[model samples]
Structure formats: C-alpha cells, structure tokens
Target: MSCCTPGSSRGGNSSDAAAVPGPTWRQNTTATASGETVQVPVPLAAGEFDMGDNFGEGYPADGETPVHRVALSAFLVDPTAVTNGEFAAFVDATGYVTDAERYGSSAVFHLALDPSDTAICGWAAHARWWLEVRGACWHRPEGPRSDIEGRRDHPVVHVSHRDALAYCAWAGKRLLTEAEWEYAARGGHEARRYPWGDALAPAGVHQCNIWHGRFPVHNTLEDGYLTTAPAKSFHRNDYGLWSMVGNVWEWCADWFSPHYYRRSPQQDPRGAPFGMARVMRGGSYLCHDSYCHRYRVAARSSNTPNSSSGNLGFRCAADDSSLSFGDPAAPQ
Candidate 1:
C-alpha cells in the first residue's frame, strides 16, 4: 500500500539510502503551555530541501510526485500535535463549533456503495464502512461513542478547516506554509525518502503510523496505536516535531488544486488562489496503500473548509523567536 505513483522518484538502491542520516532522537524538553497542559516547542531549523516525491509511494490524485526543491524561512512549530485540551481552550475563547456540528453530518467512509448512487462521496466513500452520523465532531470523535476527557495529550481529531483556522487565529499562530511543512517534516535531511531515510523499514522498525496488516479487516497495531496516540508517543523529527505523518490529517493555510505545486514557486509557495477545499498535510490514521496513502512528506490532500470527520486534526506554528518551542535550558 505504499503511496508511490507513476513518474515518482524511486530510491536508487543503496545510493539514496547511504546518503542521509537519521534523526537525533533528542530528549524531551517539555514547555508547559499557558494553560494546564504542557506543550513542547519544536525548534524549526531554517533550510531548503527537494520537495515532493517521484517515487511510487504516493497517490496518483495526491499530486506529490515530480519532486522539486523548496525553500522556507525559519519558523517555530508545536513539537506535539494539537491536543484536546488546547482545542477546548480555543472553543472557550472563540465559542467555535466545527462544521460537523453545524452541518449536523459529515462524510463517512463507505467502501461499498451503489455506483449509480448519486449521493456517494468520491474517495471518502472508498473505505470499507462509514456512516453520516450526527454529533460526530472533535468532542465526539467517533460519533456518540467517543469523548476527549481523558486523552488531553492525544492529538485532536474530527476537526475541520474552520476549526483549525479558529485555533490558529486564537493562538496567534498560522498554519505552516506548504513549503515550511514539507521541509520541517523532512527533518533537515535533503533527498531522504522519508523523514528518517529511504528504507520504509528502518532498522527493522516501522518509521511512522501506517497500516501493518490487511487494511480494513485487520491491523497488526505493531506501532502501538490503533487510532491516535499521545502526540509525543513516537520519535520526534530532527526539529523535535511529532506526528508529522499518520495519526491525523493537518489543515494548511492554502487552498488545494492538483497542479498547484507544479505552478508554485520553489520559495515558500502556499497554494492555489481558491478552491472548494483547503490543502491538508500529513495523512490520517486510516491511510493505507490499499486505499489512501498520501502520508509522505511531499504528500498533499484537500478537504472542504467546512468538512470535519474522525480523521482530521491540525497543529499550530509560530514565529521563531517565540520562546515556546521548548525550554531555553533544554539542549537542541
């Protein structure tokens, strides 16, 4: 289920493999947030990297191939995924209700549907099962059965673009420009297939959250999370960022179009002028090669600004001088 598509770059055996070094696995220097929850500040190292992939590991519709170089200015990012507690704070401050709650329903994955069903959603309906349930939102992550009370550290999900935008505005931060996201996710490595390296099986260990067994019917859960994990559960990127891939799809500031990257400039390009959907980076826990696999660093996907579901969430980024990226006493 790798995301590679036609014309994407494939690793040249051991050449690309030998070229890049893995992440430093730095110790956590937690920065207590302004509230009760603690958030680590991810120090963003400024640099450039070849963006996108030409390998066979991306989705065709994802438009992540034809890899190109992109330059981004330095900016700080949250070291961990946005948590329920933080999002709750945003809600309290802004009184925001996500699109899912407003619309009273959102797209639910359904793998089998009548082909002639005029109401059938596009790719979202490709899943084995999905239902349009009311009250499904960030608070009620999986319709009526889920709640966020105990999982304050887990990345918030079922968030729409509107929700993310509200949180960003309240936090005095902005969504990472597409260039900034890809570069940061690459963890300062140039031409590495993933943030870690070319090999998907790095040191016989799974690098990120992805499906391990038969997609819908079975999951090995080898990485220890069936759905989402605490934002800092796994290893961090070189910049100390967590959950850059898999777990949840993060909303970006730019509107989405398939060819946006092709026409976009290499320097801090955002995205298209306007589209029905905004660009969403990273991939969700549900991504699988048998289905959607747009989780690569260069990978891209789009969802309507108003759409919210069980799989979508976001993180906030701030200016470099913000003192919030981690403890100043903490080693880089």
Candidate 2:
C-alpha cells in the first residue's frame, strides 16, 4: 500500500526456493551484452549541493528534512532510464531471468489491465489499484497478454533491485548512490522543488510525466501518458539529464533509511549501512499532488530488493575514472 511502488513477497511461489538461485542474481561480475548504442552516459562534475527538502514541501515521515550539504565525486550517469530494447539486448546476451519472472507474477496497475483480466488477477489488500498478475514481468508488463511491441523506447518496468544491478554489471556501470542521485538531480540549482525549477508546469507546459487526474480512478493524460513514456520523452535538465523526477522511479545504490540524513556524512553519503529495502528516487507516473506528491527532487521511497512493479525502473551510473570521454559504453 505504498504511495508509490509497493513491496512484493519473495520466493515467488510457495514451491520456489527461499534463496535466489544461480550466480547471476546478486553478483555484479556477470558479463552480459554491451550497453553501447543503447544510450550514452552523461558526465557530471563533482560539486557540493544542498540535499533534501528545506522548504518543508516533502513528506516528513519519509525523511526529506534536515537539509544537508553533500559533496559528490565526478561520475557518469545515464541520460535516460534503461529502455525495453536495451534490456532485451541484455537478456538476449546473458539469458538472465529477472526476479519478477522467477516469482511468476508482478504488481501491475489496475488501470493497465484489461477489464476481463482483473476478474482473474489478485488485488493487493492494502492497495486495490495494484493487481498481482501472473506472468507479468518486464517483457509482459501488464500480464501474459501484454507485450512491449512498439514501445521499445519506453523505460523497462518490473525490474527489481537485483535486476537493475545485473543490468549495471552487464553494461559496465553501476547504480547512482543516493547522494550522487540527489546532487545530479538538482542540476546545480539548489532548493528547487523540481529539476526544472519551482514550477511543476512552467509556462503551462508539462515538464515531466506524472498522474494528472484522480488517483486510482481516472487519468486525464495531461502529460500525454497513462503509463510510462519514452525514456527520453521530456526536455533535459540543466545537467543534461532527462526524466530525473518522473516517468518512473529510478533505483539508487543506497539502502533505505528515513533518518539517514540526520547523520549523513558531508562528503558522498551513501545511506545506511544496511536495511531490508533499497532506496528508489524520482516519483513514478502514478504520482499525483492530491495523494502521492513525491515527484519533487528531494523526495524518496523504498521497496524490498525483490519487489517490482510496472511503475518501477532504473538508470545506471559509474565512476568518472571508469569511463573515457565520448565512450558510448559508459553508464547510460
């Protein structure tokens, strides 16, 4: 019943093993396909920026307060989330299976499912808007009846933290730390509610993709999307990054901690030492101001490592030293 991505039960089915099998699940050393030609990583210079919500516009319980200054080293970040095409290439190269696929099901938005299919799908007790559909994974986002088809450019969903890590390994990159993500997301403009500035729709134009109408009921599609949009759909931020705060939630390398900011280090703070769930930044298309107003740059949420939903996706990042200039194989 999380306002954003909901957590899923591990082990998939009752007969499945409690532990993730095979060496490819958690290891980042697995070699897969090259991510070059998919999307080039954008280089970001190291700098100090104020992190967190100082304006008190964020969810207090989610720990968006005690604005802290953080310094980050130069790094490379993907300009856009990993697209369906990019992920398919990795699967083809490594024959990897995602956690959702192993679980035999994943959480899908109720609106995305066919009316007939809802009768068969199980609904989450806390969040009726989410349907647990069998055969629902990254490839078949909605259910067994759905496919990516012409939406290859759309961000890949139903990917778990482990799945994202696997993609990062195959791409020769890594996930952005929570500090790095916030610093990059600000795009050098501190204290802004969004990457684009204080306005959600500056000049009456939608800068990012998010819910536009009543939540779990109707969608106005004002931003031109009911689900996910193209990975690079919107305009780039000051950092030349696209979709930094919307379209879908991007997974961070740090573990979740509601109180981490209070004790976070001044330099490159990575989050808590350990936790049950991982951090996910940038609200998804399901965010609405009336309910889940977490689309702001400083907002954050988390789910278990094994969790996956249609609104969840991720981008890659890497240390600057690991990438050469103009290297297409970089993080993106």
Candidate 3:
C-alpha cells in the first residue's frame, strides 16, 4: 500500500461469502421522476496530449516522470465522483456488497473518527493517521455510528477496486484508464500543475477541497471542509469537470507500475498487464503539502485491489457507442 492510503490486509471469511449469495447482480438504470439519470458523463473528443509530470515537484518513486505524448480515442467520463445516494440505489436494486463490508472493516483517517467510537482494530505502521475501523462501509463512512443521512451528495468512499468495477458493471460504465483519467483531468490544459493552472489557489481562492492546516492534527477548515465537500462544490475545469484533483482519490482502470512510464505506449496506454496493486489518481481531502502532496493532476498512487479507505472513491467512464441521447447515464 502507498503511504498516502492504507490497504486492507484481512481476507473475507466464510460468513462474508455467505452474506452475498451470487457472483453477479442485476444492473440498476432507474431514472429520476423527471426522467433523468443520477449522473451525466462528459465527452472528450479524440486527440493527443502530453501525459505525466514535466516539473520535478512530484514524487519520483511513484513514476510521475518521463513526460510523454499520448493519443487517446474519444471517451465520456462522469462529471463528479459517484455519490452515496447513487451507490445506495445500486445496492437497493442488486443487493451487492462492498469489499469493505465483506471484509467487515476499512481504513479511515484518524481525525475523521469521533472520540466515542473506539472500535479501531488496526493501524498503518508507517502512517499512524489511518485507522482500520470495523463496520466502516459506504453507508457508514466513519464507522457504525456514522451514516450518510445528510451526505447523500458527497462522493461515496470505502469502495474497493473490485467494488468499483461492480458498480461500473451495474451502471453500464467502466473505470477510466490512467491515461484517460489524466486527459480528462487536464481539461485541455497542457503541462499545468493543476487542472486550473500552476497556482494552487489563484487570487486567494480555495479552488478545491484539500488540507488547509497541519497534517492529521489541525484542519482549520479554511476551505470549509474537514472531510469531503459536495461532489459539485467547486468550480469545473476548462472541460467542465468538477473536483478532478481533490476531494477523494479516484480509482483508475490500470494495474500500477512505478516504472510503467518508461515503457508506456504513446497511443492510449492501458498501463501494466498484471500487477499486485491498481492505480489511484487525484489526491483526497486529507492531502497536505507537509505530507502527501499528490493532489496534482499528474500525481499518482496505488493500493491492493481489495483495499479501501474513507478518502478513496471512484467515478465511471464509457465509450461513445455505450452512450445515447436518451441514456440517463450518458452525456446530455
């Protein structure tokens, strides 16, 4: 696991397997009362763009170097991360279970926990800020006591890579490739530190959700968010995409390899063929420059496929043929 995010080490028990009876569940494409889907994907026309970090600001070990040109076919991506309410609809329809729920625990930031809920079963040795809290699933974000009653619009967390794939399958979408993710996140910008520009906060404005104070200790909430903000709280990029670099780390559809960039294909690179962990893009709300400064557009990280955390979530993407004018999940 990366130091920025903790990965789950526990395996699912027999009881966990028994809880979810089937291997696959029904897909939920239900429309709203007004006949609109929960999300509308944004389309990016086919083009070639510079991929990876040219500046030396990123961690070299994570393979953010050797900036290369990448050509990609047209694709559609979700404007924002998947919300708790949307995930709830899928669970309600298919009775699908998340990896965190299956494992009976997930990694949660220490600061997000309340003083009363002391059910921390484990901790990341290198980064003590992460706590393996029991019953920390999608609905119960912080733990058993915490619920998504008023946070339905917030991006859903505690979803593993497999769980994200399950959601994509049910929604008739797929996870974005690392190259595609960077392309959409760039939002037509070239070699810019962030989706907006080089400045972290231009003209004294908090553009996105990130740590505003001391790391894992004092979060002044200068950006008005200690945890995650609303999925669409901040301004969109040049391509009209929201929260592309912060709020939560998004899962990508590629196996992680720190050295992949050295041998990456120039045309729509799909990442490594096989690996121990998968790629995670965009930093989360816990990101602090003093510690994890991976909030940049080209920054990358990875974790085991079965691992999940409170600050980890994902969005979906699809090819042009899979989307239509009347498709609720497609771009309007």
Candidate 4:
C-alpha cells in the first residue's frame, strides 16, 4: 500500500496550506422538480475515448496499465462535482443522513506537524498523510471545527459511495460507468496525460487543482488552493467539465479490479460484477507527482462503498435519453 492507497479519501495533509481563488468556467443551468436550481450537465456525444495508462507510466499499482480504447453511448454529466449547497438541498428535500453522520466519524487528513494529531489514527500505515477523525463528515469536512460556511460552492466531501448514490438517486442521476467517466474526462483528446494535455503546467500556467509543492509536508498552493476549490475554479475540459482531474476523487459505478481492463468489454465496458470497492478517479487536491500520481486522465483508485473522507465526492451522470434539457425527470 502506498500513499495513494485506494481505501480512503483523506484530502491529503494540506489544511494549513491556505485556500486561494482561481478563474471560473462557463456553465449551463437547470431547475430540479423541487424548484432548486442547479448546474446543467454537459452533453457528451457518442464516441470513443482512450482509457487507462499506457505511457509505460506505471504507478504504485497496475490498475491503470495497458491503456485501451472504449466506445460509449452519449450521456449527460454534471459540469462539476456536487457542491455542498447542492447536497444540502438534496438533504433538505429528502432528509437523508450521510454515512459519516451515521457512523459519527470519517477519515481526515491532518499534517503530521503536531504529535498529538498523529495520535488519533496513528498515521496511516501505508500513507502517512491520512488520519481518521471522530467527527468528520461531509457537512464538517475537516471535523467539527470545519464547516461548509463559505464553501457552499466547493465540492462536497467526506461522502461515502452510499451517500453519493443517495444524492444521485434523489436527483434521478447515476454514477458514471468507469468507461463513461474516462471518455468524458478525456474531453476528446488523444492519449494526453491530463485532461488538458501532456504538460502538467502548460506555459507555466496551472490548469487543474493539485498539490503544488512537496508531498505531505509543504503545499505551495501554486494553483491558488490548498484544499478543495470551487468545482468550477479551474479551466474546464473541452467538454466543459470543470476540475475533472483534481479537487476531489469522483466515484464511479463499477466495482474495482486492477486488472479488470484486461477482459473488460470493448464497448461501454463496465467493471467487475461484484467487488469490495468501487472505482474512484480524477484524484484529489492531495495528489502530487512525488507520491500519488493519480491526477492523470487514465489514473485509477478505489474505496469500499461505506468509506468516507475529506476528499471523496462525486458528480452525477445520466443517460442521454433521460435528460430533457429544460427539465429533468424526478427520481423514482
């Protein structure tokens, strides 16, 4: 197990790094049945997009090895990860309580600078950058002291896969299949390391949000954010999807198997039939090239369905047939 382990969504230990603002992107809008306005998902036309890592760019695991091509049906995807305010609206409508709230705890990443802080979860054995906090939840991502006060627009975190599914269920949306996710994330590009291109920083400009400094110790905040940023903070992909490669790890609908790509169906390949963990993609703010290199377009990770953390969140997806542009169908 490496620092980029697949089980937890701890945002990485950069809480003290400070949150800086960045540019925003264009978006479409829609209203839910409950009259709550939300960002309309962009439509991705039916096409083929490359999936998985193949640049001989192997990471701590072989999950993303052997880059492959996949064909997908057209679908609609949220332009941004679900925001705190959005999730709160869902909660208000459905009275849903998140897994973190029920469990009374969620994994949180705290810097190892304070010896006392390390005593809680005793530093993750595989990734020393994470810690499990007692009161951490999506509403209080960093713990009780941390609230989504000014972060209404930021991606909602500390949500387990179940929590995300609940939101999707209420919204009449579903988690994107891994293939669909990779296709949408690729943004019509061909084998580029990131959603933008091969360059991590094109022309010395930061495109997405990821660690800008040393891993686990220092965060330079070069991208203008230490932790989660507004879902649309950075530039969007060619498909108009914002922060596709970072900010938070978006959950996928497939069960995770490192080698599942080997036998995955060529067209609209879904993951294994059943597994202990679901796929997570696009990495999080904690991602740094020095350790967790999962911020790439083809990188992959996973966590159990019940797992929750400060960096784990999700975006909603729906079949093209279901979306009606001006008004979406109510959840069944």
Which has the greatest TM-score? 3
Which of 1 and 3 is ahead in lDDT? 3
For model 4, residues 193-301, the per-residue Cα lDDT tens digits are 8889999998999888888777877888888887889887868888888888988899899888888988888788889988778888899888887877889888888
* Least accurate 10 contiguous residues by lDDT in model 3: 14-23
By descending lDDT, how would the candidates be arranged? 3, 2, 4, 1
Residue 332 of candidate 3: its Cα lDDT? 26
Q: Candidate 2 local accuracy as lDDT?
A: 0.83
What order do candidates take by TM-score, descending? 3, 2, 4, 1
Clashing pairs in 4: none
TM-score of 3: 0.91
Question: lDDT tens string, model 3, 114-134?
Answer: 856877887898889888899
lDDT of 1 at 328: 40
Model 2 per-residue lDDT tens digits across residues 1-332: 26588787775322111232232222123233454245656778889988999679887778887998888889878788888988888787778898889878999998899978743357677778888899999999999999999888899999998888887777677889988888888888989999998989999999999998888899999999999999888788887888998899998998898999999999888889988788999999999988788889999888888888999999888888885564333332
TM-score of 2: 0.90
TM-score: model 4 vs. ground truth:
0.86
For every candidate in turn, the CA RMSD to the true structure comes to 10.5, 4.6, 3.8, 7.6
Clashes of 3: 0
Residue pairs that clash (backbone atoms under 3 angstroms), model 2: none
Model 1 segments beyond 4 Å from truth?
Answer: 1-35, 54-56, 107-125, 321-332
TM-scores, each model vs. reference: 0.79, 0.90, 0.91, 0.86
**lDDT score, candidate 1:** 0.64
